[model samples]
Target: MKKRRFWTRKQWCSGILLAFFLAAQTFVLSGCGNDPAATSQEESDNLVIATSFYPMYIMVLNVTQDIPGVEAVNVTGTVTGCLHDYQLTTNDLKKIHKAQILVVNGAHMESFLDQVIAQQPELKIVDASEGIELIEDNHHEKNAHIWVSISLAMEQVQNIADQLAATDPNNAQGYQSNAQNYIRKLEELKSEMHAQLDSLEDRNIVTFHEAFPYFAQEFGLNIVATVEREPGSEPVAAELKETIDIIRQSGVRAIFVEPQYSTKAAETIATETGAQVYTLDPAVTGPEEPEAYIEIMNRNLQVLLEALGS
Candidate 1:
């Protein structure tokens, strides 16, 4: 039997057509019951984000709301509780593991964040406090609560927007727009606070903690004394005596107590100096009602002006 010679052009064309048909059949059978589009949709919907504190959380929420298919979760709860004293639960750690983006004030502010960052080396962490001028605290670092000043807070909001936009480029435009609008409101708040406190020209103010130093520095209010000689510690007897002397000598109009601690110390000073006790929430803790950063600052100014007889 003689072996057949190679096929001619017509036979070659028929062989190519058969090969193409076989490949098409294999592809259809391989994906007979699969939906790639649905798989993609499900994957896109799994993004989760978390912020460390109330102020940070609020700013993140404002920006993330406009970004489609993204959900923001705040790991820390409530405003009234001390951040340093905050205890993270197992659920908090789960959120940490699931988060794609973690926005925090900074290491100096939220020390608790250090552990989270250590555990999740791959997590994208946005330090909102970066690049802003921080007050130096020789003991460890300076005041961690920079949100007290509206001007500083405006910068913080901008930084947060930039980080979020960088992480989620698809929604960059929305983040920028939202940030601009928020900054404008903050500037307005700054002006309103200035106007509100302007009339009370020569009043002396006293606070329970040195937390209001930035606020005093910003508004030019005379902080004659702070009840707690130190930032986050109880007042010593000598410190208490000195504060009382300052109140009496300077003719201080009011004693401002923080809602985080007992008002009894301030109340006692108020009684001795004939000055009424006024509550100025540092916003380190949460508020009784709807107290955003700006709202809390506005309320503080109102209370200060009223107590000072401006």
Candidate 2:
């Protein structure tokens, strides 16, 4: 018999922020906080932490890898892919069983999380998305792709580290140190991106999906419109007509498209409105590729500035 789809509704509503929880369905979990480390002195076996995607995996690895007996494995793969369509095999289940701490962004981002948890509830599951406010999906009540902005990303990592340390007291100090170092880097990145954004003359741009709200908010960019009505849905005829009108009326400079999705729709828009179409990868793929999250984000800033003629 074929395996059942593992995504469940109960697993969808966890996370610390809107940005992290919204993308709780997609990849990338973000946040920032100054609360004292909320860790406990519990002991565990091997610290095997599995993540839904690259960003979460990065947060876990940076914190726990330096310590002995702690191992962080990212099951998201090396390509720019999404967790929504991901399927788990027997090998994945075996890995999950071996993990002492399962660190996931949250329930909504990977509906498959429910099945994984159901099979191994004893696993010390840490929802990095806890405590953050959630952005409601206009269509669905739950929003799952929250890690798009640097501000939110920082918040998520801090919380994840705290939870990991608390769950595994043996490595509390390591987790804390890692979290601090990573936080500093994230702050610097956010500052640099903001500075670049400040220089932009035009903040109006269109995108294939509504994935850059945090970035747009950070840089004060006006996302005049998106091609896709919702996270995964294609544009309807009426909506396409409306988008075309909005592009024409708003004088949008360029349309941003993610590599994971087809550019056909964006191409049509560009062809019709004369706006340049730029490609952006949200960094689902690991650092194995040069154009990982940070690089892609920096490149995106440059593309936006050049396209907008900032």
Candidate 3:
């Protein structure tokens, strides 16, 4: 992030004279000397949207799918799981420079957003969680992973659609229609979740991370304790013992772990408590198909039913 030096008077005169030489050379060389990258940039499409991670990319894809020449690109390089305490790469800075607008699941999840804003001050941002209600602990700390719940995910998608429609008025109709179609699919899945999980006898479970609060609330599941209190960090020995004690006292049957992170801690807890560890999709990773959100949520519900339905 070093700044380039200002050109001196002589340097500017020489540089301008050299540019005049390049222009003469371009005409003489049948335009082959012209930078192709510059030509491509000039011919680039109207809108370029950059997503912070996988879920945002997929959700924004639904709205930007039918709009021709509108690009919805994921910020490339090593973005594993959520962007909590994540460090930005050189490639990510480059991508941010190219993007006119950025979309995010923004309840402080993208901790590096301030750096991005500093790098690209004029870049417009669309925070999907701007007006949506976040799940909070009794102490009032927010759980920003709203996409784990279909109902909340629908709201985030609606907010994204509204933002995009307002930003790009010509394609407003397409964005609105696409969001409605996707929300209908999510509503169907919510109904399915109710039918599958409503009758479970024992709803108590533990989590690998504290990611499933909103998800558990959505399905009426009681999360007794999360083995790993934070993402990418193992719980201390005291914390682990406490979680195991909670599992035993609460008679929790299952420990839900997400795919993006390791299950070693959850596995250890399960061994101590005789509770089974099951994988659940938090949807931090990309979906290969268009209906990937619904498909993965259905699979997550199936895992919950099998593990928690006593």
Find the candidate with the highest TM-score and give its number. Answer: 3
Model 1 C-alpha lDDT versus the unseen true structure = 0.72
**Model 3 regions lying over 4 Å from their true place:** 1-43, 76-78
TM-score of candidate 2 relative to the true fold: 0.78
lDDT of 3 at 210: 70
Ordered by lDDT, highest first, the candidates read 3, 1, 2
lDDT of 1 by residue, 67-173 (tens): 55555777876645447556677888767765667888873767867887898786788888888776654465577677777887778888888997787665678
Best by lDDT: 3
The CA lDDT at 44 in model 1 is 23
Q: What is the TM-score of each candidate against the true structure?
A: 0.78, 0.78, 0.84
Candidate 1 vs candidate 3, lDDT winner:
3
Estimate, for each residue in 1-310, the C-alpha lDDT of model 2 and write its tens digit.
9776664454453323334423321211111111122112111233457775777777676666456656577655553455765677766665665565677877377777687788766667788788877666456555455667777777888888889877666567888898888778778878987876787678798977766666676678888899986546678788888888999999897998887777888888888898899875565654742125566667776777678774
**Candidate 2 lDDT (Cα, 0 to 1):** 0.68
TM-score of 3: 0.84
